[model samples]
Target: MSGLKRLLKKGLGLGDMAFSAGGGAINWFPGHMAAATRAIRNRLKLSDLVLEVRDARIPLSSANSDLQPLLSAKRRVVALNKKDLANPNIMHKWSGYFERCKQDCIAINAHSKGSVKKLLELVEFKLKEVICREPTLLVMVVGVPNVGKSALINSIHQIAQSQFPVQEKMKRAAVGPLPGVTQDISGFKIAQKPSIYVLDTPGVLVPSISDIETGLKLALAGSVKDSVVGEERIAQYLLAVLDTRGTPLHWKHLNNRRAEGVEYDVEENHIYNLKNLKPKRRNNPSNRCDLVYVEDLVMEVQWALHSTLTEFNGNVEDESDLESLIDLQFGALQKALKIPHKASEARLMVSKKFLTLFRTGKLGPFILDDVPDHTPVS
Candidate 1:
């Protein structure tokens, strides 16, 4: 009965609607957002205003700059969605950030029709003069997948109807993950008269990288998943990092192979004994602890390369010494992990360049091979 009421209210545009509701705690931007972006670009020339929605919690991380091209000629209204769930102080800072960027910013919960109307009013105010000479006006709504385009549509329709009922409120929701080929893209329209067209798009799901600890760090962080990097690999990586760090505890506790009366403490003798320790058992498939550690370190080296390249500027005084820098940070892993210097070294160089392209958005969809479609849970 409640669900039916929601459907009816949604049809009539009478009450609150669910916009883009993300299904998982960990969210990632996938094919849906990419498709929506393309659709938005195709329609930009036909529109006068672009309404961008973003999550307030991680405002900077959530905004997609890929739409800048479509928005270059179009006026923009930024609606910070889900403000109710974010820190108020953070929202204020973000609002200022958007305003500084010259974007008309409005912090509002997508479920509130009053707020939505206020947003529309702001959009109108920004474009009223521009559209005065035109017959129709176009307003493009953009956001990540599951941000709330569907609910906003219902809210706008309900407000237009001007009929508020006393019955239990209906809950509106997003229609699908991606925009369909149907006339309505998400929930937006293209108008012809001094009219307004709203474009419905998928909510952007930003990729999450919180779960990407290398095997060595994963053992310390305890987030090693057997599916990706098994327990054995993780254990091995921990031993390796500790080895390089001159820590003896990791080697001492290898598969219950503790020295007859030794402890996992930081003493000089322990360190000395650790240097002499070797895998007691040979080639046991069940005890693949060492491999895991090496893999984790290699992942770290890859990230180090990626980050360094990302932070690089035009030129440095000793720019040619970067290869040595790379070796210094990851040389031990290369030696211990038995990863050929060439294979891993090449990836680092490639990843560094890749990150540079990624940050500038020049390498669109290229990093997709490794990055997941959705953000991972922290």
Candidate 2:
């Protein structure tokens, strides 16, 4: 493992990092997924075009290879969703790369009205070359879980309604941050001159992921649930990626009540420990001293919630009650650390916060796939 880390550090210019996972392929095929595959195959005959949505950050990993055989003969357009969160330079290169392979690819922000309108225009223009007699085109939108499929549908509907006020607006598809929210396949007709109908299918993943890193990337992107791959493990991978990319680890957010300088280092296990840290009292009238360990803060929050639930006979039904309990624990932690932070700002787990920063594009855009050594980048 040490040798591998050295090689990565020297050859790829990545930092010292090593990944450890138990021997076995990552499999995430639920029963509904098989059913979705069968349904998609059955519906392919009725569809004029297939729009495969992919995450721009991890395009190759996010793509479902199982659909290759099924979609080989179908007219397809690869819509790289979440363009806003991806590196624009890499995205432009990917567009040229896809064109060279004779595939129609478009990078689009799923939530943008202009992008959705451009996507609709591409679909209509592509359909014109293939279909001359058919007045209505049935397009099937498919992709792995949480790739913004539902959001794209809603965006299209929204733009269509605004442009053609007389046309009836369709119901918006349910959108959620988590995976597997869209359970069934449904269809909606766009109010356009030619009238295009789009089918929204549930996010389906391949039966088995041969590469563990790909699975990890999917999990980090929230396509796979944290329960499946474990949140802490994902955070470790995130840390490695950030370190390799030369991004600064902003630990100031973790510091709360200490007036003294705080220092930490990332070890092999990615555990952070404070070094040369000293506590000082603030000049406030209360004369309070602050310094708290992160591990202790997490434990206190958990214990407080557990005790509250136990005392209440596990009948805490009000959302505000839960929020209050969390705030109380966070407030205690803030006071101990002397860091001025709102109770509501306290994150339950550091791992979750780390993943959130990456998902929100706070850490910056990343392309996980290894670009070929021979491939040219303009």
Candidate 3:
């Protein structure tokens, strides 16, 4: 058996896994991202208000630290987008946490009409004083990639148009699932009555990602491309996170028919019976349970890879053979994952499905960030 197979078979403890939180850093700073940063700095002077969007599921990690200085000079509003995908209780705590910091924050589901109404009300309340001084308020929308910046803008425009039928119809900003879709910074006029304008900027990341787990969370949320971080690696991190939280993988939630033949039955409520596993001691064990059994993860990966290979007329006997075949057919596996083949591909198709399930909210609502009880911000 290969080294990985042996390790998997031995059931290496979660802490022993190579992709632990303290594991090697995961960094991605493309030239385009650097250029976007410079562009944001130059354009900050044109706006009076800054709307910073962040993924509600991973609020702290999704907030880019690089833009803090630029945003600090202006009236700022933090919109935690995609609240539907996050835990409501935790989100409530996040709102209070931000409030304690004296920040104007609102949780919103960009697709919801009611939520968008609350967002507009909050924006108006925050800028009421400034709007009185300057009739036209330039609000700049900024965030990391795929945080729903464009969607938020479109929602605001729709609300403004419905409120004022005589105003000129505004063009919709382009949107896509993948990160870095908005490549340029462009301004759109939202409200004609108040003459409110919004500048939509490309999603930008800091030049360096100091936290490995934060980067992984960003990748899992689809803020960064899978190519920057191997699919298998991301899957491993997902497994670890779910395992830590004692959350079931819920394979049935995955729409892929290819996973039917796996050892896990589609009708089962949870993927693995991890209750029998030994619990890891932690300073705060209130949230997490025992670490996930390595064997379960290995089995899931093997079954997924085998099923994918079968589609391509390829076969493997066990985890050891599966690794060898993955090495030879890495490009084919990448195609199965719908990503471009790279020289160092992890070639685990199951990882893509696992991430897709989480991103699509099929696995269930999760608050990836840890939130403890705290006094409400006065």
Candidate 4:
């Protein structure tokens, strides 16, 4: 545990010169992204308010470093989306960090109507001055890839349509799990009195990433395409972060708490059959027991990780030792996750599934980005 900060700096860097997709940068700034960036810059001139949506897991890393300067000058509210998938305990600290920087910020889940309403409340408050003079108000929503910009817009649209009378037929934004889903910037009229329009832009990344670790953080958070960074590499990075922080070991305490509750319940005559809870029909893949299997799978994966980290005698601070431990845990996870022993793409499959769990938050809530040592005064 000596110099934990130094250890993470070296170990998580993983000896990569740069994060590469195809022996090059994960530079996925498509032609549309370039055109849209220009358009967004032009439109920013007229916008009254800007909602900068960011992935809650990687608040700092998911930001477009190239556009931060421009965004900082504008009237902007930082909406950290996907809060449900992040560590709620630390969310207030992040919010406070933004507050100290004098930026208007809110952590939100785009899917929830209540959450989006809170954001809208803030947006309306920000635009109170513009609401009086401007015949029409423009609120631009911008963010990097896969950070739920479209999803947030859709929720906002639904809320606005019902609350405000609009002449145009309401059309929903194109929301997808992958990046580059929004090819063109489209506007939705959310209110009629002042004619507030919310513009949804294509998710864009910088021409070049600021650093490889930032790139990996983006990839792990699904801002960058998985193919660009490779699933195995991202999963390894995830494992490394988990190990170095001793995150899985904490799961032991959580499980122990649950075990105590279960034992107490058993004593209180609440009969429970642990063995029978396993999915009965494995052949029928779509069986309802699949949910049970998923729960079991998560438990197994957690146990495997906890066991490996606890038993393995090695310095997790050392890159080689950490790599060795990650490899061992990969094998342990493959078995725990029940990947086919002889499958040609077993490792890849394991990586994909493992990443899925982490992304979907079955693994657990996480906040990948750490708070900066000094909060810049804006």
Top model number, lDDT: 4
Instruction: List where candidate 2 sits over 4 angstroms from the true fold.
Output: 1-23, 164-168, 249-348, 372-378
Q: Write the per-residue lDDT of candidate 1 for residues 1-378, one digit (tens) a residue.
A: 232222222221211111112211122335555565567678877777788776554354445545655564577887876566554644566666565566688988777877888987898799879777987676767765444566666676566445334323333444432222222364333233455666665544333323222211322222112223333333333322322223232222332322353332233221112112122334544223433332333333344433443444422223233323333435443443334567845434333322222222221111111223344332
Q: What's the TM-score of each model vs. the native?
A: 0.43, 0.68, 0.68, 0.87
Clashes per candidate, residues 3 or more apart or on different chains: 35, 6, 0, 0
> Candidate 1: deviation at residue 178, Å?
11
Off by over 4 Å in 1: 1-34, 163-193, 204-378
Instruction: Summing lDDT over every window of 10 consecutive residues in candidate 1, give the lowest-scoring window.
Output: 362-371
Clashing pairs in 3: none
Candidate 3 lDDT tens digits, 1-378: 533333234332223322343443445677788888888888788778889999999988998887786786678999999998998867888988887778889999998889989987888888888876787878889999999998888888888778777877766888877898888887767676578888888999886665666777888899988888766666655644543333433433443533464443233233333222322336645222212223344344434444444443322334444444444334443443344455353445546655665676645688887654664333
TM-score of 2: 0.68
The model with the greater lDDT, 1 or 3, is 3
Better structure of 1 and 3 per TM-score: 3
What TM-score, to 2 decimals, does candidate 4 have?
A: 0.87
